[model samples]
Target: MPMPRRRLILWLATAVISTAALPPLYAQTPPPTVAAAADLKFALEEVAARFERDTGQKLRLVFGSSGNFYSQILQDAPFHLYMSADEGFVFKLADAGKTVDRGRLYAVGRIGVIVPHGSALKADGELKDLAAALKDGRLQKFAIANPEHAPYGARAKEALQHAGLWDAIQPKLVLGENISQTAQFATSGSTQGGVIALSLAKAPSVAKLGEFALIPESWHQPLKQRMVLIKGAPPAARAFYEYIATPAAQEIMVRYGFAMPNEK
Candidate 1:
């Protein structure tokens, strides 16, 4: 070959080798971290595992009370996604310009009155019975999450008041930091009973430890769980948020006793 032709071939070969040695244009990156409500621990774990399998993106979750998590996010907690048991916190973040997109409702949760397994409590247990139990000294202690910080606790208070039993039971109440911890109080037999999310009560851990009654929906407003993508969230985080609203995820939520927003 002529000199000019050989030089041209050599340049092309060098370029090809350099490109191959460079980092992959679409190399796999580590998955984003998500800050989620404690009540969602079990269900979200399953969802996250499934998401990893389907999308090849790992999920690192940090679970805590919705209120606490909200505070941390405001302090720049380094989470790419946020899932809250109540919509108010998500809206708070959005209003503060902390979120990338409008917050969306993910699930509706039911509140319940829970007692330890084989506690001689019958189904359809009413607030009157609870009050009578407390007054008669049959039940000395009751548990509820802290109303000032937990949405479940707020609902529990509303239910008790609506039933005209809040004032009567106030002295007997022991507060937990969050619904999961409140359920822990009842399930661990530390208290006679407590109010918790139906979804948490239906978990395997709770199922083995206690039974619960669905609270009357008329007592409190709907518990609408919501999610938001952070302002600088990566594509993977947005994709995961979208995945939570898919039919597959909705089915999982329903199986765990969470009501789909569109369901009657």
Candidate 2:
């Protein structure tokens, strides 16, 4: 074997070259994680799917109340981006320097009255029928998200107050952890009716179970949805942040009943 020194040297050089050409283990970065508002469950899912198909990028989405996510991000949660149903939370994060910037308003959300089949309550856009029902003792166990943390819940409260029914409905209210859960509560026969995100009410699965009518925009403060990249966000998250503002994604959001930014 010692007689083949030249060939052995050539073989060793080839092995070193191949090893050097191999990519580093760290090169395979995992997909980014995005903390999103619960109202975005259906719409964001579609946009994320489209993003993967178009650009081969993937995102891991976690849906919750925006206010809760805000608190978690302040505690240094691992989310790469945060999408809030309320722009206020995004501004606070930017002020804290927890986000890449002040964030951008992505969409405006709306709340609606949803009633399941055989419910005595009518799916009225105005709270007129709701008022009449409450007056007559026909309303019981109505639902809304917990207003303390959920933007939709807060808006729902405002709308009720606008209709002068907040005090009357409070006693009969069921509070969901988030708006999506509120939608379930609205149609699960647990509650006679509830105010839920219009986006959720528009889903075919949810729509099939109930009738919905949009509460007027003037009834409450606008649900201004905003999104921001977290500090040290990975490239994928940044890409998503940009993609969400694109027309394709906005179209999906619109289909889900979200009013895109800059629209009347």
Candidate 3:
């Protein structure tokens, strides 16, 4: 039987968590929902899977831009925890009384250039190749997450600006909704290449599609990834939040190319 529109709205608003929803990620569950930045897609999934396997506690993880997740939390989206790619979001939520307290830094993120195999562009960390390609007309569309709301995108913009290519590259930009999609566009052969979270580029699936190199960290603001628990977080949510700081979780993050907070 076809469900009524009212019931569907209620179910979707309260239960389902998907990136395609009008306004995405959400509330309650057999286990509480966790809103995480898209940059953490690969690393966090592995950490959460380990948590579930070892502790027998399940969690519903939803990934998207950190800024969007912050807005959702402000609207009382019911996510039991939030892992933001930028620590500022967590601090802002803490000030707003949305989170229990300011979150702990879980990982330090890095952005890099990914050029799909056979592109004219080279995976140059210093962006010298990018500037050369832009000047020589070898570059057309270049993918990046939307800088307005995605932390990794913001860093990518800063790096380009530092390289003095922001204005020149502006004509050839393809903006993705988040880091994962940015990496996808970079490797899909749609665009020549792009700047995306290092963690995403490190994924075996993504790595096979391209060559990647870390953009110099000095080019932009730091990506201090942090995680926090909601005021009324469930036991599983609290436990997972704690577990993310453990050695096991940090190792998973390192595997995905993130630097630990404790590192210099």
Candidate 4:
């Protein structure tokens, strides 16, 4: 026997009412991810902490060579913001439509040479000591970030080449994947000395282990560091991006030995 039309309509209405009573699904927002340069390891951590305290927003930092991060971002990595050691990388991303726009210059980096305590390279005579130690065969190895991909490494190479020391130092060089690792190689006593970002040398971990001398900015091109917000960045990322330019964040970078872009 066929069911009556009124009974069928009543059953359909009950099903619709039960479904409507259920809660609607809401999309959850993911935490912000930042691709940061290795030189920022300490400085960014300090700034991020202050940012969190002020804004109640937490951010995850992934540190590596800026050039490596550039290649990763090109591959569609899920970073919400990028803090590059080289401004060129940020500009390249903007040109590729990967970033929101040409980002702001956040800091200027400087390079320096660090010699660990108890090493043959003493701080009193500085570079002169390095020369003497090398001539006496007391200094056998030196570490530096790989110039092929790390901005600081490139600067370090430039400084050596400018001083007519590259040809001699090249053979004894121990390359690190990045500046932080280079500092480690020097401070850990794995190498006699290293040329690294001044910002890293100012970090307490490295400062206590070694003494560093400024490499004079004239030896190489300027390290104009910049940062950008990735396209479709979350609210937290955007907020943090703006916060980086604030006085508090800039002060942290200054404390870490970074020169403000406009401070001259």
What C-alpha RMSD separates each model from the true structure?
5.5, 3.5, 10.6, 4.5
Candidate 1 runs further than 4 Å off: 1-30, 118-125
Best by lDDT: 2
Model 2 C-alpha lDDT per residue in residues 1-264, reported as the tens digit of each score: 374989999999999999999999778688999999999999999999999999999889999999999999999999999999999999999999899888888999999999999999999989899999999989988999999999999999999999999998899999999999999999999999899998998789999999999999999999999999999998899999999989899899999998888731
lDDT of 3 by residue, 105-223 (tens): 88899999999999989999999999999889999999999999999999999999999999999989999999999999999999999999989988898999999999989999999
What shift in Å separates residue 11 of candidate 1 from its native position after superposition?
Answer: 24
Residue 218 shift from truth in candidate 1, angstroms: 1.2
- Candidate 1 lDDT at 176 equals 92
Two-way lDDT contest, 1 vs 4, winner: 4
Greater-TM-score candidate between 1 and 3: 3
Model 4 weakest lDDT span, ten residues long: 122-131
TM-score of 1: 0.86
Which window of ten consecutive residues has the lowest lDDT sum in model 1?
Answer: 117-126
Give one digit per residue, the lDDT tens place, for model 1 in 48-148: 88888888888789887888888888988889999898889999988888998667888888888888865534334466668678667777778898988
lDDT scores in order? 0.83, 0.93, 0.91, 0.88
Stretches of candidate 4 off by over 4 Å are: 1-28, 124-126
44: Cα error in model 4, Å: 0.7
Task: Give each model a TM-score.
Answer: 0.86, 0.90, 0.88, 0.87
